[model samples]
Target: MTASVVLKFPVFTVTEFRPLDRQIPKNHPSNSVKTYLPLKTPRFPRQVKARTTLMEAAQSGSSVNTSTNASMKLLFVEMGVGYDQHGQDITAAAMRACRDAISSNSIPAFRRGSIPGVTFGQMKLQIKLGVPHSLQQSLDIRRVKSVFPYGEIVKFEVVDGGMICSSGVLVEEMGDKNDDCYIVNAAVYVGY
Candidate 1:
């Protein structure tokens, strides 16, 4: 019978276990790396537009409502963010994107921040389907907008995927990369 041993590190001696059946192949290319991973991300800000009724209504002529929107900032902490091979977590990177959104929105920093009990900040959201080649989805037309517990957001859209633009959302930064969506930190202007 094999006996279980209780040992503490620094006190007990340890040895590396080498696999007897396998060894690194001699002919393997130096740069060749193998790993089980998902698809490579396309790009930040995805260089796409998520058009909705709002965007269309804004651009429409005559009877359509012509509204102007101001920018704002909001803080965010994403749980999932990472690279497929390197195990890179994109949470901080996504948060950085959210922080960048603040200045991009043209709203005062403090205005987008919370004042404790007073409640003066934008709420977080989960990105459903990212904007694609057109404003509408391939199958259905969805009116995409950042939802806030407070109220409706005037004007907001995807900026970049964290590659080229600043104010945008990244699903990799939302939840585990394995998930389809992630948490989104948005900037909303209230009292306007």
Candidate 2:
């Protein structure tokens, strides 16, 4: 027999459980050492919700459909930087991830329904870092964040006879140069 597994992190996941009450020896190894006891665990569910990328905000932002039967590919790009208080390149992982995603086999999602003049749609995705990593512990980078005062959603238009199309972009940024930290800007294009 075979089994399927889904894994999520940080809370109430496969390995998360509250400890049950049990007596422990007074002389434990650590000061907080109460005892090595089993936790109150719930029975494994025979079934669970199976929707991908809907459980949390981060999942929604970075979600990808994995069904191999469909020829279309949907992709998202992410880029950011970690800055110390001094503002030097703490990390550049975000830029690398975004670059790989855009250059890989994934493409952006298109309009599901049709419009009068539109036959297909194109999307350009980008992620920019505004804050230093020193403050990152407080923010959830995995989730979508609207740095703008209001929300923004890019629109796609699939116009007629779109045999060949071209796109162009320039990404640049300027911040406290004296701080000398890393700020990541990334771009993505999606098509099927």
Per-model TM against the reference? 0.20, 0.23
Error of 2 at 32 (Å): 34
TM-score of 2: 0.23
- Candidate that would win on TM-score: 2
* Alpha-carbon local distance difference test for all models: 0.34, 0.34
lDDT of 2 by residue, 87-187 (tens): 23223333333344344443212344332332344333333433343533433443323331221224211112101111122223432235343333333
**Model 1 — which ten-residue stretch has the worst lDDT?**
77-86
Model 1 spans > 4 angstroms off: 1-73, 77-117, 120-129, 134-142, 146-151, 158-192
Model 2 stretches with alpha carbons more than 4 Å out: 1-42, 45-47, 54-74, 78-123, 126-179, 185-192
Evaluate residue 99 in candidate 2 and report its C-alpha lDDT on the 0 to 100 scale.
Answer: 41
The global Cα lDDT (0 to 1) of model 2 is 0.34
